[model samples]
Target chain A: MTEPLFDRVALIGIGLIGSSLALNIRANGLARHIAVTTRRRETLEKAEALGLGDSYHLEATEAVADADFVILCVPVGVCGAITSEIAPHLKKGAIVSDVGSVKGAVIDQMRPHLPEGVDFVPAHPLAGTEQSGPESGFLELFRNRWCILTPPEGTDPAAIEKVEAFWRGCGSNVETMTAEHHDLVLAIVSHVPHLIAYNIVGTAADLETVTQSEVVKFSASGFRDFTRIAASDPTMWRDVFLTNRDAVLEMLARFSEDLASLQRAIRWGDGDTLFDLFTRTRAIRRNVIEAGQDTAKPNFGREPGNGEAAPGESTGS
Target chain B: MTEPLFDRVALIGIGLIGSSLALNIRANGLARHIAVTTRRRETLEKAEALGLGDSYHLEATEAVADADFVILCVPVGVCGAITSEIAPHLKKGAIVSDVGSVKGAVIDQMRPHLPEGVDFVPAHPLAGTEQSGPESGFLELFRNRWCILTPPEGTDPAAIEKVEAFWRGCGSNVETMTAEHHDLVLAIVSHVPHLIAYNIVGTAADLETVTQSEVVKFSASGFRDFTRIAASDPTMWRDVFLTNRDAVLEMLARFSEDLASLQRAIRWGDGDTLFDLFTRTRAIRRNVIEAGQDTAKPNFGREPGNGEAAPGESTGS
Candidate 1:
């Protein structure tokens, strides 16, 4: 294994991203010690039981004490408070970072609280699953995924390099951009897509004529994909939308405008418009597959099983 | 081997669904002879090259001649014309069915063209991949997927039973519903979802600040799942939205209303509203996975690969 990059690395939360980071650090020997802290004692106990860190603490200050690398792994809404709690306890030369989805808001929240001499860099590893909690994380979660760093202007180059090296060690490609640009890009790519998914699933769930059970039964038709995205961590997504409001709203507006046009096309039977848009979108999937961001296997590589019980066999009426 | 369900099966299209049906029919001995036909000579040649049928014909009437079962596997928009083309050549008491996405429209279109004594049952197998064409099909595509039949009222019961049994033989569970209900259910589950995906991908592509390359590079963050759905057969989806206009528009209106409320939540910083919706949608995903419609694997079971090139290493400037 490579030489340890940090003597003591403290994680401020132990959810999916944190637990995965802890496992990655241990597996890659990226840190000599990992200290994990969470608000809930049960979560701390679960992290310890899972061997996510060498030391567990209920207090953020305790976790950050003597730590050279402190990564805030909580929801974006809580990152500021966590930073305020742990700021005074951090080592003088510690490199402070985060794994929040909304980088600009995260940076704004944490930058003022950080003590002098400590480097603050906001990072977002564009990887996760629908499952959450400490048990949901895996060692290879970051493999081949992007870890975007939105370092504030004039931040220490050495600190950014170390953080970049850390992500590379954990098998993530690194890209640096201004936090504003990052938020806009993520708004279109992540935030709005998720919002639309949550919205559609909610719509389907709320339908009177189409029962929820029927929706679930026929989900393989296309609705199931949206459900997976809509199933993402609620608190984290809430913070994402709240903190990245302007960008998400902007993207949603554009999405709504485009959707209205499409709706009209359907109404007027403008098959050409629908066909052109559909064909154009097909190329993006190909690009994503070629870029190594997604799989090329059919149906997202889902395994075949016996089809759901036949209608006559299961219908009770 | 099981008894042959029919003496001859005629497939009027040789795309993904048609070819997969052809393969499934041969593997299960569902038909003594599989006759394939397509409007394009190239598709017929490709199906022949893949050995997808025993007899290949360029003309729909030629393929349906003396056939016991004629499945119109083309887009919903073309079902009526194709049915009219093959109606005169169909054997007496021949079962005419289709694998179209929009059932109500398909039944409306084809029911009038089918001659007396010919059975017209509209079937939609809720299974497919983003890829299309004869080469993209496999024998197992229909395994574990639901096939819904929307036969018109007073249709021959024996013909309906045969169609249901045919789907079961192809490894699909069978359900029967009215054509109107089928269209509404599918409008929510398939058509609107596809329309939104296509719209969002178009929106992302048209962004000024967020370049197309950036969207492509960072698509793994939820946007890529949509691209897969958006990549589906454009001609098929266009026809679906066109024919299922009323249901799709209804669903879209509901979706837009829900999205407006969500947008307000985000704008007002109402985290609880966002959180509640996100949490509620999660249960649907669990149900879908348990129902055997989707996989539980993280990131849709994408395989691990080497991370993209390190940013610093790739930056020539």
Candidate 2:
């Protein structure tokens, strides 16, 4: 067997991403020991029952004891609290990172609590499904996906490299950018999409003219895709919106303005404008397929690492 | 083999829905002969090359000649022209049906041209992928989806039943509703969703702050789903907006009001409002899942459907 990359890997908040990392660590033997911790005892029990780690603890301090690598996998709003709780217990030369969607806020909240001996590296995997919790994760979730790390200035390079290698072991391609850039990128890609989806679904739900049953019945026409994305974990998304308020608001403002223009076009019967915008968006979908982000399948498999392997994978197309 | 339901089946505008119906009719032997016609000669040639019909015609009159069942599958905007052109050629007892998204406009456009002995029925099969064109169709695309029929009052019940049976043969569950209600229902379910998806993708494309490359690179979080729907055929969707103008505008107004409230919530850091909306949307997703509208696999099998037969049959989830 290959030698373990680290003596101990502490995962603070054993949810979807955390448990997936645990599975990846065990599957690839990336760490000699795995420490799983969460704020809730029930979730911790679920993680332990799934045998997702070598050790489990309710307290962040208990979980981080002697850990060489620590990854924060909690909701972004909770990251600051977890960081403060675990800071004093971090081992010397430990590397601390996260899998939050909003890097700027994650860095802002988490960087202050980090001890001198530990490196606070903010990261987002650019991956997820609507499902959450420990049972919803798999080792292959990160395969062929992007993991972006946003380390602060003057952070240790060796620590960054080790974390990079660990993610690569889990089958991710790594990219480094500033936390601000990550927030801006995701605001357009992730946050705005989720917001619009949630907004539209909410709008449909509140419609007096059309019932919810009707929406569900006729959803195959295109509304259902938005519903699936809007169904993502409420707590996680709430935290994402709250923490990344500025970027999301900025993106939302732009989206609202654009939507208003579209509304006017529809009002005045401007089919040409509608067609032009619709045609331009097709190129983006093509680019996504080329990036290996969107598969060329007639129907894309949902849920991370489930059903069938991705097109880029060797098992099958 | 089952007895043919109609002596001749004429399909106008042989694109995705029409082509799929052609395949379904041939595979199931639902009609004794299929006559396919499209406005463009190139599309008619492609249909002929695919052996999609017993006879192919560029003129609507030729396609409808001697046909007992004539199904119009063109964009809603062009319904009137095709109906008026083929009116004199339609058989005395023929049933003229359409697969338009907006029923009231379709009825208004096509009804005046119908002969006394002919029945005009409007129906919408709530199914499709993002891909369009005649080549981007399969026999099973309508399997288990809803096919809504709107027959004007005093129309022959026999004609409606026959059309309903045809959809059932194509593997759809049929629902009957008034043309007015159908327009409103679709405004919320189908039209509004497409409008929002197109608007958001357009917003991202037009952004000065977030580059298109950045949007394409990180679309997986949620934006990509909107792009897939937004990538649907521009002409078809453009017609949907123009023909269903009033209902679409009404729904668009409701959506804007709700979006404004959501915008205010986000700006004010009202987490509870965001959380509640996010939570309510999950139930709609569950309803969609239970209704068998969403494809079962996560990511919609964008992987294996491109090549392999994935484990599950694709039910649009």
Candidate 3:
């Protein structure tokens, strides 16, 4: 059998991404020993109960001591402080990484605190559910998803390749790009879409004309799809908008400007403009499906016997 | 077996909703005979090929003649002209209903041309996918879905109950409201959500810095969900905006206002504001799930073995 990838690997933060990573690392024997740490005793105990790691620590320094690789799986907002605390104890030649959603901000936060001889490779796994916490994770969360790595200039080629292989072992296809490019691409594809979803759900809830019950009861008509992403972890998303502000704002401006034109077309009864834009958008859905980023099944395959209420029984999505 | 609900039913459009209705009607024996009509010969032939109807015709007059029930299952924009063509041939005391999305405009379009003896009831079945045409339908499309019926005040009570029973037989929970209220409610629940989905997809496609391929690659983060509804039928959506202009504009303005505040909070780095909104929206998702409007499964159950590319394989959603 192949040897484990690392002798000792430290996973800081045992939330959804971290817990899922723990499951993958252990299930695939990606690391010889797993050291887990988190801020809360309850979360750490839960991780222990789940057997997510070989050893557990409350302090960042304790977890990082002599670890060959360290991955910060916490929200991006707190990476800098955690980096400072763990910098003194990081093993020489240790490969440091993260599962942050925003790359440029995360790199800027962690790169300054790193001690010499440690290689930092920042990555954003394009995989998640709206669900969070230790219990919400599973073994297959990262399987078949893209894990994008953005390493700083002059970083060791050997380190990047090892990290790439590590993610491959966890069941992800690895890609690399500049942090700037990753932020812009994610701003449109992930961050901006999430912002729109949160904004719209909030809007729907605040409306006095449409009761909250009404919105909830009638949500199968497209609104419920937005709620899936809108329901994501609040702390993680707050940090995302706080750190990736400029790129998100730029993409959001484009979104709002286009929405204005659609609203105008509606007001003026310009059927051609509405029809043209609507037709163009359909092609993008086809591309997303064809590229394997999504499925073609109706309603995302939420149908009868999939736990939905069948006809003459109950109302469901 | 009990007698069928009607001796004959005339359905005047062979699109997604029409074809699905035909399947349900025939499968459940809601009507003894189903007569289908559409403007396109190919669509009529496709419906026939699918065995969706007992008889098919290209002319509205031919389909409606001697029919005990007539349903205009066409787009709202052309409802008036088709209603005019079918009015002169309507059988006395026949119950006429339609499956249009917008109730007020469709009522205004069709009510004036109906002959004296026939009773008119209009309904909007709150169920569909991002697919269209005769073939893109299924028997369970209306199962566990809400179907709203908006009948003109003082219309025969017997007619309203029969249509409700027919939809109930087709596996839907039926509700009644005035035409104006139905338009407003649907504008928030269905029409506005669809517009937002279409607008965001259009905005992403038009970006110069972000390649379309990049958008497709990273779409699993959040944007792919929006693309599902954005791919819905163009002509149908165009008519929705055209006919339900006031309600959609009202909802759009409210949506834009809420988004502006969220954007301002992002620009100013108000983490509390962002966090508060994000937290509040999570509650809405729970309500939707508890109401049976959605499931709590991660990524809507699009996981490994659900046709997704699994770990150590290829990329997938």
Candidate 4:
């Protein structure tokens, strides 16, 4: 077995991503001491019951004491407040990072609160499920998944390597990207798709002609797939849209414009246009299957039997 | 075992649904003689290779000759032509039904061509996968699913009962409804969902800012689900939209209005609205599960490694 990556690692905000990281770190012996913190007392107690960390702390400041690396795993909206609350307690030369979906806002929000001696790295782990909360997490959540780190210019190379090594130890492939680029890429890929799902579900629910009962009854055809995504934790998504407003809105504008064209084609009964677009999308699914990002299992590669993936079989590649 | 439902059952256009019905009929001894017809000679040959029927015919008229029951499984656009060709050859007192998604248009198109002696029962088996073609089907596809038969007014009660009993032997729960009601219900349940999926996928593909590669890379989050539905047979979907235009348009209009409201909420950072909608959608999913319309398995109840349930799993309740 490999040596422990860090002597002590602190996780602030032990939600789905955070608890999963702790579980992975413990399962792999990646850290000697794993300290966890969450804003809610009940969540900390639940994490304690789940044995997600070596030590649990409700206070953000207490969790980071004596930590070699501190990873903030709360929602993006809370990153700044948590950083400010814990900044004074961060150990000298400690590396601070986050498991946020949006990168630019995270840096802007958390960088100022970090002490000069500590290295502040903004990282986004492109891994999650529709299920949220600590109980929904698993040890293999990040395996073969992408963990992107966006470091501001002139950051210490040693600090960057340390953060990269930590994520790698947790079974992730590390990639370095600019904060803006990360946000833009995610806006198109994750953010826009999520927004669209939420909108469609909302649309289906509000229909007077098509009762809610009917949408649920026949959802298996196509709509049910969107429901899993749409049913995601509303708080996390609200923060995502608010923080990543520019990029998300840009993608939405493009999406709306394209949707209008499709509406027009449908109205005009243009089979050729519909056929061309439908044919092109098939390649993307093939690409996802090939990348090992998705399993070939029928019905979106949802693992069978258990609600989650089998033991040691991570959803990500 | 119960007696065979018909002396001879002729299926015109043996695609996924048609082929599946043939296989189920054979497995359950629902018919003594099965006749298959397809526009393409290659499909007929392939159906023969799979032993889908006792007799395979290229001519629609030839296939229906002396048949006690004839089912048109062709696209909605071709229903009228197939009905006209097979009308003269149909045996008197035979029951004729179709597995078309849009019942109203199908009835209108085929009603003129049907002989007075033959009963026309327009049915929509409320089940299917994204896959198409004969090889893509299996015997247990309709098990525990709903087979909705929309018999026109003044139809013989015995004719309806025989059709209902045939579908039941193929592993379906039978329901009788008017052709118009079937069209409206399906417009909300299946047709509108397919259109939205196609439209969204088209939108994603046309984005200049978000390359196709990025969409594929980050698709596991939400977009991949839509791609699967969008990848369904183009001709079948085009025919569905064309035939179910009014109900689809009405449902689409409602969907669009609700989508616009959700967009406004996102723009204005209305977290309450987002949360409320997200929370409410969960109830419908639960209702679907309770109604046995959705499989209890995490991913549509098709578990990996469980070959038994996977092959013949019901697409509907």
Candidate 5:
């Protein structure tokens, strides 16, 4: 195999994303050594049992003592404190980055506390399941997915190139953009979608006319899709909304206005307006399918044997 | 083997649900003969090519002639016109039912036009995919799914029992309710969810800051889930919103109020409230999975080989 990309890489929090990164690094020989740490002892022990890293440390500073690359995998709200805790022990000229959903706030939180001469590149990988914890990860999670890197202005080009190459080696297509642009793009694509999902699920749950059991029983129609998105990691999403406040709020405002117009059309029996919007939205799904961001299989390719009849029942129908 | 439930069953508008019903009727020997009709000649031709029925016709009256069971599978808006056209040809004591998403409007539209001796039962099968057309169906589409029948009061008991048995034979768990309650329940579960999905996909497409290509490329994060629901048949959804106006409007108002509160929490950085709401929603997903309405597999069990890396890359990671 080719030489590893880094001598040692340190992960500050070995949750779903962190454990997946560790597995990918090992699978592709991207790093020679992996150091894992977490605030909770049980999580550290779980990572150790899973063989997620070559070394385990309870303290963030010890994990990054001799590491050539350090990635903070904690929630976005804790990046600043973690950066401050590990800044003293980071190897000279070591590159620092984070796997955060929100870019601008993460950079603002981590940039100042970094030691002089160390490089910082913030990234958000557009791939994940609605699962958390170390056991919920796999090496193939990042394959063919987008890893967006938001390098602040005046950063070292060599460090940015190295981070980009690292992500590519882990089987991700890399893109570079400003932190502000990244935040806005993610606000629409990720943040607001999640917010609406959470809102609808909550609304369904709190309805007096419809029982919760009925909602759960007949969810296969459409409400189940929202439930899946709403089941995402709570801590991570909480930090996402807290950090990316302005962009998410702006997108939510636009979404509310559009929804109000749709409501008006429905109340007034304006079939033309509803049909036009529904037709326009179908094109976006086609675009997403053509772009290979999702599969073309019905119901996201949910297998037939799970609850539906066996596949043999088709009989040429 | 056994005797069929009906000597002749006529299906008008052989689209996704209609074609699926035809297939189920054939697979389980629920009917001796199936007659299919559609307004479009191409769709009728496609149904004939697929052998979805024993006979195909472009006229509703021709399809339903002398049939014991006649089902209207067209959009809710067109149900009244088609019912008026087919009423004159209906056989004495024949059962007429419709598979429309909105129940009250369909009953209101079809009841007045049905012949005096015929039985009218309305149903909305809580099953479908993001696909439409005669060829996009299979025998197992209704397997283990809910099919709710909304029959008017004072209807013949024998007709309701026959319809219930027909649905049961098609592999659906059946329930009966008033048309008003069915509309309200479905508004929260199906109609409003579809409306929100269409709205968000539209909002993402119309953004000036983000290019459409970028949104499509990075959709796997959360936006892609909404796209699946948004890609549903446009005419059907338009009719659903128009016919179920009162229930849908009430649900939308509740959703908007809840969304505004969530937005306020995000603006003020209320992490506790966000965490509580997110936590509560997770339990609903669990309930859905437990109730067998959805699969518990991550990412809706989208297999890796569909577009990304091959399945062999997992290696138990």
Candidate 6:
């Protein structure tokens, strides 16, 4: 067997990403020991029941004892507090990271509290399904998907490389960008898109002219597509918006301005404007397909009788 | 073999729906003969090459001659002129229908031009994919999907029943509603969703700060979901907006108002407000799943390794 990459790996907050990493670690022998910790006793017991970790701890400090690597897999809102809680317990030169969607806030909240010797290499896996909880993850979730690392400048290069190798072992293509760029990129690609989805679904759900039953009965197209993303973990999404507020707001303004013009075009019978925008947007879809970010299957490869395999992390983390 | 449902079936446009109907009719022995026609000689030649029809005609009048059933599988914008052109050639007592998304406009467009002895039933098969044309059609495109018929008041019940049976033969469950209600229902469910999807994709494409390549490379979640629908046929979608103007505008107003409030909530850090809407939308997804209108599998049953069959018609007609 290949030598283990680390003596121990500590995972705080054993949810979907955490559990999946636990599985990956065990399957690949990435760590000689796996320690899982969560605030809730019930969740810790559940992780223990699933045999997801070699050691389980209700206390974060206990979980991080002698650990050479620590990854926080909790909601972004708690990252600062959790980092403070685990800071002193981290072993010297231990690499620390996270799987939050918003990187700028995650870095701001996490890095300040991390101990001097520990390397804080912030990570954001652009991979997830609508489902949450520990049971929702699988080994293939990160396969052929992007896992972005936004390690602060002048941090340990060796630490960043090790984390990249670990993610690659979990079947992800590694990407590196600044925390600022990551937040900006994620705001347009994931955050604002999710906000609008949630908004449209709310609008459809509350309309007096259209009953919810009618909405459900005839949800054949675009509405149902939004619903999947809207159905993502509410708390996590709220944290996402709260953390990445400025970037999301900027993107939202742009989206609203564009939508207003489209609305005006419809009012004035400007079919050419609509047609031009529609045609131009298609080239981007082609680019995404060629970049292997999505499936070439029509309707996300979902509507076909003999369906193609859908691309991973369809909505967001 | 089972007795044919009709002596002859004429498909006035051999596009996705028409070719699929042709396959369904051939597979299930629903019609003795299929006559296909389109304005474009190239399209008719393509239909001929595929052997999709017993007879292919460049002239709509020739296709409708002696045909007991005629389906206008064309865009909503051209229904009126085409109906007037083919009016004199329609056989007496023949059932004529369409597969346009907007029923009220379609009825208003086509009914006045039809002959007295012919029955006009405006139908909408709530099905389609991003891909278009005759080549994209498949036998199971309408399987277990809804086909709503909006027959005008005082129309012949026998003709309506016959049209309903034809949709059933094509493996769709038929629903009947007034043209007005159908337009209203579709406005909230499909039309507005499509407008917003198209709008967002346009917005993302035109951003100066974020490059198009960045959008495509990081296109994993909500943005990618929209690119699929935004990638849908520009002409067909343009027609849908042009013909179904009022209802779409009404729904668009609701969506924008809700989005504005959501934008305010994000700006104000109203986590509870965001959380409540996010939680409420999940139930609609469950109801849509229970109604058999969509798949229960997470991410439209996509993102899973062994994916569930994604429900058909993920985007609008």
Best by DockQ: 3
Q: What lDDT would candidate 5 get against the real structure? A: 0.87
Model 1, A61-146: lDDT tens per residue?
99899999999888899988888888888889999999988988888889999899999888999888777899988887787778
Candidate 4's residue-wise lDDT over B139-225, tens digit each?
Answer: 666766667888988999999999998988877778787878777777766777677677667676767766777766666555666
**When only chain A is evaluated, what TM-score does every model earn?**
0.96, 0.93, 0.96, 0.94, 0.96, 0.94
Instruction: Rank candidates by lDDT, best first.
Output: 5, 3, 1, 6, 2, 4
Candidate 5, residues B10-67: lDDT per residue as tens digits? 9998888899999989989999999998999999999999999998888889989999
Each model: TM-score of chain B?
0.95, 0.94, 0.96, 0.94, 0.96, 0.94
For model 3, residues A1-317, the per-residue Cα lDDT tens digits are: 58998999999999988999899899999999999999999999999999999999999799999899999999999999999999989989999999888889889989999999999999888888888889987887777788999998999999999899999998888999999999999999889888988988998998888888988888887788778788989999999999999999999999999999989999999999999988999999999888887777777766542255322211111
Instruction: For model 3, state the Cα shift of residue A247 in Å.
Output: 0.4
- The whole-model lDDT of each prediction reads 0.85, 0.81, 0.87, 0.76, 0.87, 0.83
State residue A152's C-alpha deviation in candidate 2, in Å.
0.9
Candidate 1 C-alpha error for residue B223, in Å: 0.5
Residue B1 of model 6, lDDT score: 86
Stretch of 10 with least lDDT, candidate 3 chain B: B308-317
Q: What is the lDDT of residue A180 in candidate 5?
A: 96
Where is the poorest 10-residue window by lDDT in model 4 chain A? A308-317
Worst 10 residues of 2 chain A by lDDT: A308-317
**Per-residue CA lDDT of candidate 6, range B1-317, in tens?**
87888999999998888898999999999999999999899988998999899999999999999999999998889989999999999999898999998888888888889889999888988877777789988887887777899999999999999999999998878999998888888888788888888888888888888888888877875588888888888888899888888988888888888888888999999999999998998777777666766565655655442223221111100
lDDT of candidate 2 over A1-317, digit per residue (tens): 98988999999988778888999999999999999989899999999999999999998898898999999998888888888988999998888998988888788888898888787777788767777899977766777667889988998898889888988998877989988888887888888788878888888888887888898877767777777787888999888888888988898889888888888888888888988988888888788677656755554534321122211110000
Clashes of each: 0, 22, 0, 1, 0, 0
Off by over 4 Å in 3: A305-317, B305-317
What TM-score would each prediction reach against the true structure? 0.96, 0.94, 0.97, 0.92, 0.97, 0.95
Scoring the B chain of model 3 against the true B chain gives a TM-score of: 0.96
Off by over 4 Å in 4: A301-317, B295-317
**Ranking, DockQ, top scorer first:** 3, 5, 6, 1, 2, 4
